[model samples]
Target chain A: MVKFFHHALKFRKDVCIGCSHCMNECPTQAIRIHGGKAELTDNRCIDCGKCYMVCPVGAIIVEADDLSRIFDYTHRVALIPNILLGQFPEGVSISQICSVLMEAGFTHIFEVEHGTRVLEDAMTKMMEEKELPRPLISTFCPAIVRLIQVRFPMFTDNLMLLKAPLDIAAMYYRRKLEEEGISPEDTGVFYITPCAAKIAAIKSPVGEESSPITGVINMDFIYNKIYTKVKQGLSGKGSCCLPAMQPLQPEEMVWSLTEGEAARMPGRTLAIDEVSNVIEFLEKMENEEISDIDFLELRACDQSCAGGILTSGNRFFTVERLRKRAEEAARGNDSMIYDTAGDSIRDHFDYLNEHLKVTQIKPRAMDKLDEDMEQAMLKMRKVQEIMKDLPYVDCGICGSPTCNSLAEDIVQGKAHVNQCIYVQKRWEQEGKLQPKESMEILKEIWGEDKF
Target chain B: MAERMQFEYNVDGGNFTRAGFASSEIKKILKKLNVDIGIVKRTVVATYEGEVNIVAHAYSGTIYVDIDTERIRINLKDEGPGIPDIDQAMEEGYSTASSQVREMGFGAGMGLPNMKKNADEMHITSEVDKGTEVEIVMFLNNKE
Candidate 1:
């Protein structure tokens, strides 16, 4: 049955070494080893590019969106993600990067961080109103949001349901530019995104019917443009459009880290950072271990936005520097931005009602268990009975983690029982069954009688 | 086909390193049974929390798990120091854990509260000098 959305196109099969790097890193068990290849289950994929970022072979590449339409606009604006800050270390300042983008046929550069400020203000109001449910997970990363929608649907209500920082920034930018008499059709706002998930989010947001983003320009490609302009602007003071907003000094940049989202909001909330920690927290929340807390800020990456897989900075140094920078930029109190941004955008930004439409797709009925105590016991006995005859090396050369992981895989219809090494060896030793016969037996045990 | 399955786990309070073993085994068992992910996760968290509580707070105990068509029921009976105030323990961030337990990141005073959160229905009976018994029930329904 065709299931998951056509989001993750960066996954190239030839480059996948079956290292399970993507499997381990993926928030959902979407990518699994099926027939010795990294097979993604359409039902399981949230299109969160955690796998894309961590793949060693660069096997996964997010298909770049066609932003040629943005060139159609008389006034084009590039919204740069904060992680781009890590790319330009030695040569150019952020202002210089902004100057470069203007020279690159763009009219202006609006740092997406500006949207972060709006979100911060909105979150503060959200906290004060206490309108959101306990453990309000962040909705900044579309992949993470989709992860909740698909894998953790029960927790979907627990999510903030608000638009991400980039989208918030886009909303404000569009409205502000329109107010200045700039026609909405003539103004194109493209995000210089870190990952393809953002690009896909802009193209097709799951919760919302439409997205504020016009298009995406990959940060990897645009970093060179920023560099070229940095060199040219330094030599000759190039005439270019000046950005309306400035980088949040040094202290404000700390919002790039893992817990920065929660810290920015003027509220009493818990900010749990890191993917493992986020998983543990979600598991706890699902179990109902944590409640009554007003807000929950979760980022799949380790060190917030600065530590995103798309960035080039050393995670440790970037986090330390970003922390100091955020503190310095904010002038010690992080709430200043929220207090000063006024209430217009802040009030609207935090107002999120999911109103999501989802079809809870259960697996085919033949896969469903009897749920009988006797059947479960009978299955367990058969599993043990099968396990004893098989050697328990768990080499995974048998294509399973162990005789046990294989047993579970077989029972779950993820694998055939004959894949067990012991079963194969028994067929070899007993001479009663051929390899094909052994495979047929496996299929039969797993309820695949058609084999 | 509503069949009943019962399993018993011996939880030892003597060792901290061996904690979560029972829960992990049960997770494997549930996975093999092709139970729903929601049910498996809830059972894992509940059993793990209960097992950890037994080792951390109880003298020694046993967890009885009954799996049926309708629900998964776990009854944890322990001879450990009973809860002094169940009401206070239910609150978030409220804990009786010591500094040593805090060092291991195990005791944030979140154990009982976590258990209560995961289980659909929970009942606790305890005495300070005698022992503690916690019973939890989780329905297998797909909907919340």
Candidate 2:
């Protein structure tokens, strides 16, 4: 059986050292070291970029659309998240960044958070429907959505069936352009993404049939392009060509930070950041050890999107900067320029709301040993039987994260029982396996060079 | 096939931090065995409530789990102050836990009731000043 799962984080075999760092650090146990290279299990990987963070040799790469793809459309719109503004230092003004994007050939720049205004009202309406399940999990972070689908399949219904802000923003822009006499083919909406999951979500969305956004540009790539222009003093001169900017409200400005959505949600809501923290909390929630939570805002990154793997700035400093900006917006002391053209998102609220909902998300659980119950039971018994001979110590020398995982692999015929160093040592002591034979197995796993 | 798998886990009483360990292990095993998710949720909830009861009231306890193709049975036996009246103890609001345990959010009077609600079959037996044994059985194939 073939299972197709779109993953944005790519593992390059030539660059991997097979050091086991990525294999050990993966939260989903999606990576394995074999033949001196790291292999990613497609269905198991959530594209959370955890392995990308730990790879010392830069073997993992985040695939994004090339910048030149924007030029294909006559109306090029850059849909940027609020975190992009946080990536800049205080000395770099918002207008400077917009001017750089405009100089780089973007016809219009829109803040992705502007769509949150439409979402706030829709979410309030959703909370009013008591028939929905309690603790409605936010679908804000794509990685968290995928995590729930694969790891906690029981909670798939708990996910909010609503489009993310990026989707809303992209849809609104595309429709707005269509109304203005520009064809959909001529209007290209590009999202500046902070993580690989967002890129994957756009490429092959979970609950949605298709994405409105035309392409994706990594935030780091755009940050470098803008910063270099600012340092060269070219951004200030290009401010004359800056389009009328839409000033984001204080709440919308901080909508991607931790507790951003939870603060706005009605009832007893809780926001959890970091993937491991979310996993631990969900485990207890699944066990019914915790209850009465009306809403849950779960993010895959630690500081939310500020800790995105593609972000270039320090997560803490970026959070602090965004918070300060939000305070300024709240106080009406924000010096950023606003567009008087009255092309506000509020004007297109009805149109955006009509397309706000996503379809029901189906669970794609990765835990079962087999599709059939009897076969799974047989596989489970085989794993348990193999586990009796192997030490429980989670030494990753076997290329699997834990001994239990190695046992599972052995049952599935992906690995051999002799791949375990402890089992090999025991067999050698018993004279059942020769040293030369064990060394050959190590060479097969770690490559001929590691010996 | 009528094959069965049995496993044992020790539960340390008065340690609320380690209360749900056994339930988590059982949940993992059931998930790997391709049990229905609805069945998994009910079994885990029933097992968790029983585990917490052992930690909240007993001195120490042991959980014995038996899994077959059709059902999952868990037996939680604890050595501690046994209940004098099983009828009163089964009530939702009746708890003999100390104020400290209540403050720590453990000794909720709902433990037994919750276990009964999630499990397909539940039985409790106790001897005064001796110990308590709780057995919970959940059907894997037929879920309500």
Candidate 3:
């Protein structure tokens, strides 16, 4: 079965230092090093971009758009995320930075604030209805969605079916441009993104929309260009000169932070971050231990998307900036802002279908014992028995990540007992290395090193 | 009823934080077997709920899991205060958990219902003051 979904992140082997940093640090344990090179298991990788952050030599990269297509669109909408608002230097608003984009050739800038308000209103109604299962897991994070697919498919029903705010923003404009007599194909929406997962989301969205976004431009990929423009006196706009640009309210801006959506949920809720901690909580939820939880907002980054690997600023610094700006914007009159007026913002999301559902996917099976259950039991016993004969220390010297893994690999027919250096040296010292099985092991173990 | 292999776990009821460890381990084993995803999901959900009940409501328990060619069966037996009314226990939102447990966001009386909904076959037997035993079975090859 085709296991892993499409992932945009790439691992460049030539640049990899193979320090085992990505291998040991992977939350899902998707990466392993063999022959001094790193390999990512598609089945185990959730595309959370964890390895990208941990790679010291910058071997991991998400394919980036050069922004060369911006001029191709007759009407361009630069969809600046709220996270980007936190990236600029102090005293410079995002509109000022966006003005730099306009100077770079963007026709217009549409802040993704309207979609945030629509999500708030729609989710509030869903919360009030209380129709779905308790603890509705937020579907906003693409990495979290993939996490469920590959690790916790049982909770598939719990994922909120609403399209992500990015999709909503893209669809919202594609139609608005069409309504204004501009061809839908003529209007291009480019997302200045925070992570590679978002870029993957644009290419293969969970919802049914085929290519909701026209293109995606990575945050750090264009940071220097925009920063240089700001340095070149293209910024410092006093008023909102960008067309269709709306000030983001505090509630909408908080969505970029961890637990931002769950805070709006008044009942028992949880907002979790960091891929490892997120897995811990998800295991409890899967066990039905935390049924009282009404909502869960989970992010793959340590502190939310501000902590994403694609961002320019440090997480703590940028989160502070984002929160401060959002607080100031919340005190204003942004269109479709969340307030006590209790009005429906469904009209804002009219470009999207009334009901959008994420395509259900399943996890890959990596450690199957055998095709036959009866044979599988026999294999299990053999593995356990072989484990006793080998050293217990979990050293990853034989290309396998651990001693236990090497034993399993032996049983899986991927490796042999002699691949272990300790086993080979012990046999050689004891003068028992003449056995045919031990000789075969001797050839492969040292084939790359000594043989 | 003969099984190819049976696994056992001793659940420590004292630590509510470590309640899902056994269930997580079981899910890994099942995944390694290349079991059907639907069956694996149900098995994880149902038995996980069973495992948590031992931690939350009972004193201590032992979970016995038997993996067969066509099915997976788990029986969780606890040695603590048992339910006086099994039917009422199955109802949603009827929990006898202490306020402390409730404060931690558990004990909404949804655990048993979640177990029943996920398992292909579920059987619960309880004796007042003796203990409660939950048996959940999920078929691996049942296409329907």
Question: What TM-score does each of the candidates earn?
Answer: 0.74, 0.97, 0.83
List TM-scores of chain B, every candidate: 0.93, 0.95, 0.95
Worst 10 residues of 2 chain B by lDDT: B135-144
DockQ-derived CAPRI band for the predicted complex in model 2: medium
Tens-digit lDDT string for candidate 2 (A207-271): 88999999999999999999999998877665533334466789888999999999999999999
Greater TM-score among 2 and 3 belongs to: 2
What does DockQ give for each predicted structure? 0.25, 0.71, 0.42
- Measured by lDDT, the strongest candidate is 2
Interface RMSD of 2: 1.2
Identify the CAPRI category of the predicted complex in candidate 3: acceptable
The list of candidate 3 runs beyond 4 A from truth reads: A1-3, A128-131, A232-240, A333-349, A353-386, A389-394, A403-413, A421-451, B1-3, B12-18, B36-61, B77-144
| lDDT value, residue B39 of candidate 3 | 77
TM-score: model 2 vs. ground truth: 0.97
Where does the lowest 10-residue lDDT sum fall in candidate 2 chain A?
A236-245
Clashes of 3: 2
Best by TM-score: 2
- What would you estimate as the lDDT of candidate 3? 0.75
